[model samples]
Target: MYVAVKGGEKAIDAAHAWLAERRRGAKEVPELSIAQIREQMTLAVNRVMAEGSLFDPDLAALAIKQARGDLIEAVFLIRAYRTTLPRFGYTLLVETAKMDCIRRISATFKDAPGGQVLGPTFDYTHRLLDFKLAAEGSLPDAPKAEPHIGPVPHITEFLNKEDLIQQEPANDKEPRDLTREPLDLPADRALRLQSLTRGDEGFVLGMAYSTQRGYGRNHAFVGELRIGTCAVEMEIPELGFAIEIGEVELTECETVNQFTGSKTEPPQFTRGYGLVFGQTERKAISMALVDRALRWKELGEENVGAPAQDEEFVLYHADNIQATGFLEHIKLPHYVDFQSELELVRKMRAEAMGTMQEAAE
Candidate 1:
């Protein structure tokens, strides 16, 4: 409403220069290369790709470098860049059972097929930080095995054979693609899963934790958690055949939660599902818990008014790019608004003093 700030371009340029210098830290210290980030900081790159919903590790690494190691900012960059890409045909749904699992385990069963391969996990390692790695950023390579080529079986099939778990009827209906359309309320299970797949890892983790803390108790057991590479296929209309185009790393989780019989339904165990873009077991497990909580209505359970139970709340706030943008907007100048508040306070003080003087007289 007021005159535009005159020298903003110059000020912005100067501020940006300062920021660049700060980001680099020191000229003498060697700069971080994209390769170093891609290889050494693999987890960060994976997280960015997971949240960004883009599978290009190289592009993600570049974005991470440009964003100065801010994962949320890197995600934003990747999202913006992704929108410009031309729409292509969709890929086929990945087959988890056929996954060449690098790591697979089942908590509910002791003798799961593939025999609980503890492939590359930090679960058993001590928390102590070895400062020796600071000087020499390398270690003696651990033993590696030729991966099992045959299909590793799922633990759920065993329970399904017994008819102890609730049967999930196959629904071939096309799921709503949230990426192409604006999000709508009363989202379906697929839509909710889409939101969670690209949602903030920490936010999803915290919401899942709330369930364990009695906010919305769903006694969850890790029925199966697997991390592996799976083939990505697309059906070529001209060829009339689905052919493998590439492969992607994925972390898939299935949780068996408690179930109570309703008046109309028989008692059986319920399920929660999670599938993330990479080896992110914690995120995947957490995603399953929150995913189950949001299904209160579908499960015929009463609304406990828990945060995770609110689908609208979870889906809306799950996006990190939106969250960071709106939150960071407050840092912008609010000169006019501040001036109005300052004038009002000054006037109120003056009037108060005048009234007190009159009363004294």
Candidate 2:
């Protein structure tokens, strides 16, 4: 797909300079600082971090600023930068149960163990724009409450206690890495989860929506959704133990799917899980639905040929970087390629015309 751009060193340089100037916009206005983007435009930063498969907020914010607020372009920059960094050993498995949750809610039960905490949510806010924000004014500090003392229990635990939910077997084996190796078909749940976690938000959301709209209907209930920071631990081989390296903000969703019963086993509700970096609640919820849809085979349910159920279709097109690269390349210099296509069309038309003329004669 590489097209040779004959020669335009000066022109290219000028274009780069122009782009930089345009990105700065109106010299009078203050240029947005990286910290502002990191703190203020946090949601945008989170999306970039999720898609870029990188967890660095400052770097994600820098990418967002450099890309002129184009999130996809920012993700592309972050991904490109990610390749140049040295690889470190993988961290230990994160335990969501022990996460210091800032926000926790359950759609299934009105009263849950840890109690529903609607922390810093836009759920109750009206969509109307406030003109007051346009003016420079300070707002009153938000009310604060004491943090919860013990580990927040999962909602699925209630269903599990009565054997109402299917129990997934624990496996200690290391899962395959999609980044390290070529993606093969019939991907395990681990690999699929890895791809979905970093997949395009919109694409995943659409696929998940399709399933709910009867494409592959599996009634889903949000057993619990939690948003908070979890400590990331990395094992030190020298010390022979793991140590807390850092903490990362995360959103996790657990869905209780419809029950399946057979002659051999009793009816039990199934589960779908989604975990992503940052407070991307929507993405996390969508991911859980899609994950459940993709589990038809394992769940002993028939695949209804749904888009979400098609592993190849979902995984192949999930990556925005790959999709954008191929799509945007069409706008690039395709002189040689277009000329060949033009010649072929002309030849076909000429042959058809010649045949028609001979028949008329």
Candidate 3:
């Protein structure tokens, strides 16, 4: 039996049709290709991949198109798709030291080991509007030398050799997966870093900015920032040896921050680490700063009630989906809620007026 269309159902159907028409735009205008988005909108795809924890460029591109260029929605779509896939054995720890680097630079040192490869950055370019680009113009490629191959040593290793920086102890413990398990309070460093990696970029950026603006100000120097491809390998149960699964582009950031020694400890520079899915230096750097701020308690420093230093605050508010869902839910019908509120206000006013009349009497 066919039922009559309700107000909401009819409205939803019309809205969907309108949205589809809007997504297409004018008939004369050429449609945006998935290839174009995959190539040109690389950053958006990267964010989706990073946040979704799925590294398929084609799928990300498709999601971006379906979402009408909303990267967060694309990320959510990818994440939903990812949840359906069967889990296999975990991969081996990537050897980042052997990364095929495209870009690597350090703010601390004049010249780094592999030398600074500017590689595909907008760092030196001026923010100018070019009318020619509006008509589909392109610029010539910048000059760059072939980067030094093999394992390029980290700059902090030099400082560590001289006891100038705090030593990061090697941990043999397996990291906890946030996706598989529920997030608990006072999370360990590994769990915290995982949350930050997939957290909303804007939220993390704001938290980091708050720290720099004196909310939890810890003087941070970029120890090193690198963008590169690293091989991901998985040990096959059938095979005796591990086989290379694939390569992924990654952005890694390490921040060296000022450390004040406790009564029993000696002074040494401390560090914060950030690793993300692609060419996202700003997010990576911000994550490191926020990570450092959150570690104040472990370092024996006073928790000055800063927003970044509060683990509960950062972890709870960082997920865009959680934030967006709650935000958008305000649009839902609230007739009952409003009616109750109106009744309460009217009753209060009546009581106040009665009291005033009694006083006058």
Candidate 4:
């Protein structure tokens, strides 16, 4: 009796060992600590948290280290870990107005009620790399300041007073969670925004840039951009009062886009909003513009046939995890399919040769 060869167990173990060794690199070099990764490679951690929908910076850092600095893989790890977490209770809607904002700015007005605070941005920095960063260094501590600033108000409140922009309606209706439900056709604003927030940064940015290059261009202006930590509160059924569960850093962007008066409605400026789970201003701003562009239909605007306007096109290709997984899976074995195709081609060639011989005869 003949027996089939079996090496699956050994193969898997060897592959895992090899992967671990490679991830660790040369034994001579020191391993990267989670804290180091979190502090030094903050942007990568931010991306992972944003996409993974997990706000734990330390866990994100650990995922990055395990992934060997592959941001996408790190994101995947975080996402896998995030799925295992138990859901306690839903948080009460965070009030941004009460947010002790560290940074806030508005492009609509030169000077607004809440004065623009350009806090912690790389915008003004030169593109040139600082060579000093190549070596570990520390800077001297600066002087401390008093902490008694009054609560800052939103600049949009001023515009709302003038009736220039549409006032947002507050609804007590519960919004559907996209993560728990399969994405459906004709998604609402909340679902679309949720998808965009967790989407790949580059993909969203490219879509936004395309809009600027005359594809669904809505003439967006950065109406406001704010980054700060906000308290997440949850109401206890027994207590009958909301309590602060935790705090999460977020970046919120609101874009003011051109709006034309329809036959039924008066002309007024419209807005697109983006809120991300970390300090990701670029992604948030890009998302807001794309969100506005996608709203053309609801606003009674003509279909521009732009990439951003195509809901299916934008939503389907936005997630890097889904895209990369499908792309890389092509590398896996498909010997049976290839063998079938090979046999078909050989049979066709043989048939052609036979026909040619008969014709010659």
- Against the true structure, whose TM-score is highest? 2
Report, for every candidate in turn, its global Cα lDDT versus the true structure. Answer: 0.88, 0.90, 0.87, 0.84
lDDT of 4 by residue, 1-361 (tens): 2233445888999999999999999999898999999898877888899998889999999999998888899889988887788887789888776666667888888886667777767888998988777676775566543321446666667778889887777767687787677678698888899899989999999999999899995898888888877789999999999989888888888888778777755788888898997779999999998999998877888887999999999999999989999999887766666777788888999999999999999
- Tally clashing residue pairs in candidate 1: 0
**Residue by residue across 258-277, what tens digits does model 3's lDDT show?**
88787645788888888999
Q: Is candidate 2 or candidate 3 better by lDDT?
A: 2
- Model 1, span 1-361: residue lDDT tens: 3432435788899999998898788999999888988888878988999999899889889999888898999999998998999888799998888888888889999888778877778898898998879876677887875555557777887889988888887989999887788788888899899899899999999999999998885889999999888899999999999999999989999999888966655788888999998788898999999999998887788889989998988989999888998999888877677778888888999999999999999
lDDT of 1: 0.88
Model 4 stretches with alpha carbons more than 4 Å out: 1-7, 142-150, 351-361
Writing each residue's lDDT as its tens digit, candidate 2 over 72-170 gives: 999999989988988888998888888888899999999898798888778999989978778868666778655454588899999999999989889
Which run of 10 residues does model 4 get worst, by summed lDDT? 143-152
Number of backbone collisions per candidate: 0, 0, 0, 0
- TM per candidate comes to 0.93, 0.96, 0.93, 0.92
By lDDT, the candidates rank as 2, 1, 3, 4
The local lDDT score (0 to 100) that residue 75 gets in candidate 4 is 87
Model 3, backbone clash pairs (residues 3+ apart or across chains), number: 0
What clash pairs does model 3 have? Answer: none
